[model samples]
Target: MAFHKNLTRVERARLAVTKLICPITRDALRVIPLTDFIFGIYISSRYRYVYIDNPKTGCTSLKSAMAELELRGRKSDLDPLNLEVIHYDSSPLKSFVPIFPKPTLSNLIKNNYRFVTFVRNPYQRLLSCYLNKFDNSTAKDNPQARRMPRGAAPGSFSEFIDAIIGQTDHDMDPHWRSQSINIHYSRVPYAYIGRFENYATDYVTTFHKLGIPADEIPTLRHLNKTGAGRASLHEFYDKKSQDAVYARYQDDFVNFGYPYELPD
Candidate 1:
């Protein structure tokens, strides 16, 4: 790509890995046993669209809309907002069996289906995860999560970021995991990856890519609110914490077009 000519070596390398790495063979696709742990992947053999849901990036709403799309078809008589998620949940470890036959799962991956997902600014996503999962004084989480100091969120954020930057992708939760790591660029061929920065506008374009008309798409709904009781990303990130986010999730920033520098 001509764009690659202008990118720095590191940026170009991330691009190369994201684009060049994932090339799953038909035989491999055929043998991947469907299970509950395949968290956010939605395969619609009916519409031939495969959606990989990135948690905390409007996944619940997207999955619900997708569930209705699968159940009601492209021209849904049902409302997307009223629809429920039958196949997917945010729990990274839980999985759902494919509605399609075992053999058909292979064809869906190998055939005409468009594979799509949305990504967010990694720093913002990290903040959202902390607020939703750790900042809460009431909710139960991983025993490790309980240890992140509250109130002094920037320090906690910095501490948490440091831990995961050194850890493997699977070792961290999806909310804190690197987007590039989640997608496993080398093995999965995703047809479209949109950014949540331009969510409403980009979503219309994404819906079209999924073979759904813009009119057919519902008014985008907000299902989850990690922001309600907490401060936004801006309030929690100091210069040190900001730099940590940049260093830790730079692949996401470079690949997804987020600014490298944090806002003042």
Candidate 2:
């Protein structure tokens, strides 16, 4: 579909080969996950901006806002709240690998593109992931949840932490994956790394970095909020769960500068 169109020629060719060999390999040689990782990286040549999406870290709002800028005040078919539309090929912001050849992308990365991403506190991010993806209301419909091993109780936050402790970032869903891994911090030279904790102000800085005029910067909207009421981290986290999450995403805390202890 349009989503698959985001695959570069090389990626498409790789996928084709993987498809043929996957059956023989009992689907052990899957490339779809890697392709999905690439899909999280959106680029706009017109704006000279590259946004690496960190799921559950204000990505929907950021992408939607950027799409608005890319569309140049025109109405967009992509909705911030609609995951399918915002992420698909029809969106104004294009995936980097698919839109530019490797050499061109390398040049742009080295000399032009302003790469930016937002990261949330690991504790909050994991809680949000569970509330959105593993809750009884959502888990049955979520593909990632289905693929996950059945151990965590439908809405048990601590169990959810237990369920994914050993999984590598490559195999884990981006929503709960380490923020540093999601953004490939070691590999990508980020021009700005905003914190989800300071979303309102940080996004304005991001829009300015993208060269969006102050008057033209779209109002940031909160999209894909999980559950109703204020779900505090303390309610779901205890010494064990907090320590487990810290161990799992310690790199995120270190790389993103979030404190190890939960904030009051």
Candidate 3:
């Protein structure tokens, strides 16, 4: 991971520590069935809130905001450009595992600590994933590229859909994984479910629900912007691709109340 020369002493120290710990921690967590869910979950003991991360659904922005809140200042703010720092294990926002015991976690869940997550329209999300990973020159290096079916074309939206359609969420990368599986919708009692389409307003509402005062609520910084810019859904989706995405992510459509048909 590249570190910015502009990073402060404390930030550099934190990043160094994160680099040392993440590899060991990730290797240990790999055997657990709940690894994905556990890693995605960020809980704030001070604020009594939990944020479940869903990739490609404004996760970077929301996590940065959460980090700001956790630190109690925007000063020496998180570098939106560097994901490693934002996701550092030393951050005030802690993940579920290695931090809370099962009994303690159960009690927190039973006590109704606010659980929150954001999701995007599957149609848009799939296209975004394709554009960001498969369509880019860096496609060959991405792990997802290796998962593509033998004959599938790199950067072909329809082919990308076909590749993931046959795989279960557990086998798929989180970038294109089903939202329901990523959020563990049935397993966790989410107090607020935000929409990426309506992120600007929904995030503020989420912060309010988390009991953050209006003045103290961290601003949602738009970061890691990817996918063909200003591109329309029609540019990527045709009948086959659209239907396949809808079929694969039907649970997301039904659970999140997103319409099946593309918007004009």
Provide TM-scores for the models: 0.69, 0.81, 0.78
- The total number of steric clashes, by the backbone 3 Å criterion, in model 3 comes to 0
Off by over 4 Å in 2: 1-32, 73-82, 99-105, 150-155, 227-229
lDDT of 1 by residue, 1-264 (tens): 112225677644543443333234222223231121145456666667777657678776666666655656344354445433333342211233232223233355666677888888877788777666666535444543633333223236656666666654544556676777665444566777877767778777778888887777756776777772345666677777788778878788887778977533
Ranking of all predicted structures according to lDDT, beginning with the best and ending with the worst: 3, 2, 1
Better of 2 and 3 by TM-score: 2
RMSD of each: 11.1, 5.7, 8.2
Error of 1 at 54 (Å): 1.2
10 residues in a row with least lDDT, candidate 1: 28-37
**In order, how many clashes per candidate?**
8, 0, 0
TM-score of 1: 0.69
Ranking by TM-score: 2, 3, 1
lDDT against the true structure, per candidate, is: 0.59, 0.70, 0.70
Regions of model 3 farther than 4 Å from truth? 1-33, 73-81, 95-105, 137-140, 146-153, 227-229
RMSD in Å for candidate 2, one decimal? 5.7
